[model samples]
Target: MSSKSEERREHTCISCGINISGTSAAKFDCPECGTLIYRCSKCRKQSNLYECPDCGFTGP
Candidate 1:
C-alpha cells in the first residue's frame, strides 16, 4: 500500500459512524449509546464542524 494508505486513519464511531481519530479530542460520549464517538473537537481550529474523514458523514 502507498504511504498515504499506510498513514494512521481515523476510526468510525459505532453510534454515528464518524471518524474519531481514536483521540480524546475527537471522541465523545454518544448520549444515544453512552459510548464515545467522533464529536466536535473542543480545541479544534473550527467549531460546528463534524464529518467522517473516510465516509464523509456529516452531523445532523
Candidate 2:
C-alpha cells in the first residue's frame, strides 16, 4: 500500500482531542461553517463544547 493508504486513519474529537476514528465516533458538520467535526461517544454523551476551526462557532 502507498504510504498515504497505509497510514492509520485518525480522527480527533474536536472537543477533547481524543482519537475517535475506528470507534463510536460521531461525525457532523459545524452548523455555521460546515466543517466536519468528530466526537467520541463519551464526549457526546456529556455534551462537550466544540468550536469550529473555520469560523470559531462554539456549541455543545
TM per prediction: 0.26, 0.82
Highest-lDDT candidate = 2
Per residue, candidate 1 scores C-alpha lDDT tens digits across 15-56 of 344565655555555445444455534435344545544455
Candidate 1 has a TM-score of 0.26
Shift of residue 45 alpha carbon in model 1, Å: 4.0
Give stretches of model 1 more than 4 Å off. Answer: 1-24, 40-44, 49-60
Worst ten in a row by lDDT for model 2: 1-10
Q: CA lDDT, every prediction? A: 0.50, 0.86
Query: Considering every candidate listed, which one attains the maximal TM-score?
Result: 2
Which lDDT tens digits does candidate 2 get at residues 1-60?
548654467889998998876888888989988888888999889998888899999999
Question: Which stretches of candidate 2 lie above 4 Å from their native place?
Answer: 1-8
Q: Model 1: clashing residue pairs?
A: none
